[model samples]
Target chain A: MNAAVTATRGATALDIAAIRRDFPILHQSVNGKPLVYLDNAASSQRPKSVIEAVSRYYEHDHANVHRGVHTLSQRATDAYEGARETIRRFINARDTKEIVFTRGTTEAVNLVAQSFARPGFQPGDEILISALEHHANIVPWQLLREQVGAVLKVIPISEQGEVDFVEFEKLIGPRTRLLALAHVSNALGTIVPVEKFIKVAKQHGVPVLLDGAQAIPHTPVDVQALGCDFYCFSSHKMLGPTGMGVLYGRKELLEAMPPWQGGGDMILSVSFEKTTFNQLPWKFEAGTPHIAGAIGLAAAIDYLETIGMERIAAYEHELLEYATDRLSRVPGLRIVGTAANKAAVVSFTLEGIHPHDIGTILDTEGVAIRTGHHCAMPVMEFFNIPATARASMSFYNTREEIDRLAAALEHTRKVLG
Target chain B: MDLKDLYRDVIVDHNRHPRNFGKLEPADVHADGHNPLCGDRLTMYANLEGEHIKDVKFEGSGCAISVASASLLTEAVKGKSKSEVKELFDDVHALLTQHDAAVDPARLGKLAALSGVREFPARVKCASLCWHTLNAALDRAAEPVSTE
Candidate 1:
């Protein structure tokens, strides 16, 4: 990763107009102006391939998987299992048995807590997380602490929004059961050095869970290479459907942990007296799974592979640099996160105007950006502000969109100030 | 009316320089109201005289609609009887939810500016926060209510 070549390394004179054509949603107008969407951190827009895959699953092969012997059922099972394999390979997991289908990252975290953390954790046992974690990552631990008498420890972050590695090292001790942290912050887009953190956690014999909700979409994630105990991400944020996510837990750890949910598919045999749970992955995923969601995710993964993740990451980094430099120059605008490495998320505050006001004015100009705390109130508290206006980008976003956003911010400042 | 109409000159004015924006120190009743969906919060304070609201005030952070509505609500119920205020609150709720219910702007006074809030579906809670908190505070007037 050459910093100079990646950051603000200008587009390769490659016509982005052709690439933008792939996303159907981008070719529309909002509020009588051409839409310039910059809110990819929340959920990314899907390409035609992903959408068609979902439709094809429903139209041709739709059935409950795992036990069916009929042709449609076999097809469904094959397609579903094939998706699991795709995910396993995409994240570079050691085995397909390690990948579990979840509703999303929230469920994945809850599953780990309920299954592994609950029974063993004691009052003095501390779980280290970062101040930059989303509510999903924070609340589950708080709930687990209440239930199991475990203590929640927060890893303080620097003003630049990067987690303090030195401080995090000090926080880990004998009683630390798990270390859960975000790979890339949803609000600030600060990319955490996971491999280094994982190595440290491994030395302490504390399992690490990487919340790859932000990282997986931007770049290739190799769970085996990173040596993380668990990794989780949502499909919707990666051009797939909502209500479906992936949790990649090491096979040994998952096998040792009890089942989180119990239903039709999760069990091997059930009786009035005793019930035996099914094998790996299935035990974690109970009841009817998100069949369409899995199909959509596979499509999203295929589409991403076709475009090449390296190219996408490179293009997005350039876009982030361009957006950051331009937005920074705007009068009264202050960019919040200045980490050396980040995804294409830019959170900023304008001098006199509120973030909500800026977002409203931008909406009128057909530029969509997120406002408010971006779901990390502590991060806002760290900055000593109530909220910020965030303009997040994706591979599909163009330089022209960022210019429109910058122009809109200028107009908003003029009007508000 | 266009949804943007909610952001009229008067609405923006009230949002910028809200009246009765501080705590009613020695407030007889205090209560908090929150819109969990969007994370908007409002803390209300009232100084009641027998069955009347002698003075009312509020403080919190939220969208422009929320702050403006709080200001308008405090102004409307300040010197009014408790029962009169309750009836007024009901009238405001009806005006916001029922599109066909014709409400005279003059009758609502400063709150008339917020009538356009109905056009923006997402902003209805912002307009109702003060009213809801006032109700909560009044419910616990005899007993001390902790707004926090």
Candidate 2:
């Protein structure tokens, strides 16, 4: 395959300087030095459009959405519903009803655990999740296992951090009710072959819920093409506002499942004796939602749309390669995940030196990085390390920033030694 | 002088050549403490002479702050009574946590070098996890000796 093929007519480099200008926080200092914010996996810094959209909603369109006869209500409802449509188009979902807004990815997973998995789960029914899952993906299924007598099966990964497909296939049986996995690993940055995995799960008559929390921000995601039953992702991780997230479920599946929560907006009618439920989306979105959050997310989607996801992904891929090569040359340094298909996250450990020490020294030089298990303790256990120093990147990250990181790591080795 | 003045040559020397940094066989008390937040792990062994800590040895993985703090702690507690060690630990902890830059320097000894850590609040765990675990180990021994 021509891996180094020239860009096609449609392919263009992302204007990062122009893009960087959209995000105000990118220009700042930390620890008396310029901040190189590489911790995008934890959460992304919001663009000005997203930030302004949120403020605008609260300033101008501040009212309860859905069923208000007033103009402000209609305006608020339009903005909120408009945000839903933006995400629906972004993920390429079939209908707006499939995109149910939730607090974030954690709530989205819990919604599925409570509404879908909890009701049908029985003894011998297995829930297969990868070793690279964040605690959000792990704990909800654990709670469901305790509640519904379901068994939690782990899909192991190779030392290089790619999910062991053969082992994953072996774990999948007729008993597997669900295959919940991160689309892109929060710790390792291994972008799993999710579309293929979804197809395999479908063959087994099992549903797949992708934790697209990391994937959506970095790459293009199409629910229709992936053919997954559900996809969940947090807006905050995608340069949007914090409190909002999207859960894309197949319409038939969502309609069949009972509502996870009961409140005003979710119900069609209620009496002391009985209660009736509303339609999809609203049925899942109970009470007053994060109005400004939805507005902000829509603006974030617009920002990504303007830049183009493919260009962003390609740029980040280049940055990842540059960073990997740079970090690999450092003596006594070992890269944790070397999966062929990965995002821009590079997790590594220095020989005989603790990650905390690495993080502290780097911070002293004005480079901020995340150091620890990264909330994926199983991945840490897999590597047999207590923790790792992770430098996650986004479209904003540059090769120069990566050089800064490399220089800081070298300085750390000298200082700590 | 600012707290950065606290990172004196003495502190760096102790951090580089940590005192009593080895395992004690047949140790009277052995305990391990980990700061899960930062992933610093420390294992400490103490040979008790009745209520007094005859010897305290430490081995683990951590940042310079934690290793240095542990080294300073070992030096301060040697030859002191168990009660004196407890009192000294309290005094050192209070000194580190104090917001006032004018904390009396006489009480902290070489441990005073960590006053710089207070400026970087995030590293407080790196500086204190070992000390907190030492207190836990001592309390667990419970021969009229409270570690905290």
Candidate 3:
């Protein structure tokens, strides 16, 4: 078979119209107009395959995994573990043993903070993170700091929303124990130069954890290549089901850390006095787990792989450029987060208009965008704004939708001005 | 529901140029109000002479509905007895929230504009944030009130 031809707009090999058809939610109307969903950064619309896979799991293979000797239980166990292998390949991790499943990215981060980092933390030890982190990354470290008397140090961001690399290098001192940072910022869409930071942390003998919830969907992630000791991401943000996420840790690191929670499946044998913990991945997962969610996530990974990640990234870059150009022309509109390297998210504010009003007006025009602090309150504090209206794109989103967003924003100005 | 119903002309006008939109010095009581969902924040201040409201003002940043509602609330509550302000607050609350509650527009006057917020269920908190703060200030409560 011949290689797929790349589209004229960058290296995207996707047929936008064909891809839009795969998502069933895209065909509906909201408030008498065709839905223009630019809220993919919040949660992406799942394809039919993912939805079907989830339903298929519940319909045919609904059974407790690794508990019974029945055919259904074995099938469930096979599918669930098969998903772990798929995730391992997707991120190019060394082994499936490093992969752990949790409720989502929040739980994954909390688990690492509580289990791995907390034990080794000492009073006055510094935990370094960026200013652009979501509350999920910040709060967990703050809680850990409060418990262990550790100090949380933030690497300040630049005026353009990018993390200050020079300041970051200066903040890494002898007392710095761990470095946790967002691979991609949810609020500003700024892709952090994590590889360079990871190299610096490695020089200091500090392990790094990357919050990949916002990165994995937009770009290709290779944990082995990134050299991050821990990486966590959410499935819901990547067109998979909610309540399922992946936590990838280096093999040696995970082996050294004690189990986070103790319960049914995370144990090898349970005696009254001494309970032996299960090995590797199973040791991290303690409960019945979201078995169907794992299957659906595997289907999502298959879908994303079918359409290459590089193509999707390129297509979304084009969309972001188109949106930025169109929105820039609107009078009195200020685009926030104009980082040199960024993702497909555009956050902005119109003069004399609150983001809440903008959101309300946009919804009337069938344009769905997120208008809030985006769970990144510190980012808002840095900008000195209450909130911003963010329109984030996916590969399936069209240029016409960007135009609609601009028009709707113009309408908002007219109504509110 | 129509967007116009929620964002009436009067509401828009009030948002553009809010009345009593500043700090009142030597104020007897003041309370801050925050709507965490949308990040709408305002502080309500009142100078009371015994049981009578001598003056009231608010200062903060928020959405159009919230600022407009606060402006209208300050205008309606100034120079009234504490009991009268309390009664007006109840009436305005009923007007903005109760779907089928009978309300006379002429009696409500400028405050009637906020009745449109009832259509947009999510914005009810935006319209009520200032009123809740005002109530807190009247009761001389020290803690900030939050419309979570």
**Every model: iRMSD:** 3.4, 3.7, 0.8
Q: Across residues B1-148, which tens digit of lDDT does each residue of candidate 1 receive?
A: 4435767777777878889998789888899987654446789999988899998999987777788889889889988988999888888987777788676767788777777777766668778988988998998876754769
Task: Report the error of model 1 at residue A404, Å.
Answer: 2.0
The docking category that best describes candidate 3 is medium
Report the Cα lDDT for residue A2, model 1: 15
* Model 2 Cα shift for residue A344 (angstroms): 0.6
Ranking by TM-score: 3, 2, 1
Best by TM-score: 3
lDDT of 1 by residue, A1-417 (tens): 011122234443333565566789987888887888899999999988888999898899998888788888889999999999999989998889999999999899988888889977888899999989998889999999999899999999999999999999999999999999999999899999888888899999999998999999998888989899989999999999999999999999999999877889999999999999999889988898998899899999998887778878888888999899999899999999889999999999888676876877788788999988888888887898778889999987877778889999998765554
Clashing pairs in 2: none
Among all candidates shown, the one with the greatest lDDT: 3
Give the Cα lDDT of each candidate: 0.86, 0.85, 0.91
Stretch of 10 with least lDDT, candidate 2 chain A:
A1-10
Clash counts per candidate, in order, are 0, 0, 0
* Real A-B contacts recovered, model 1: 0.03
How much DockQ does model 1 earn? 0.28
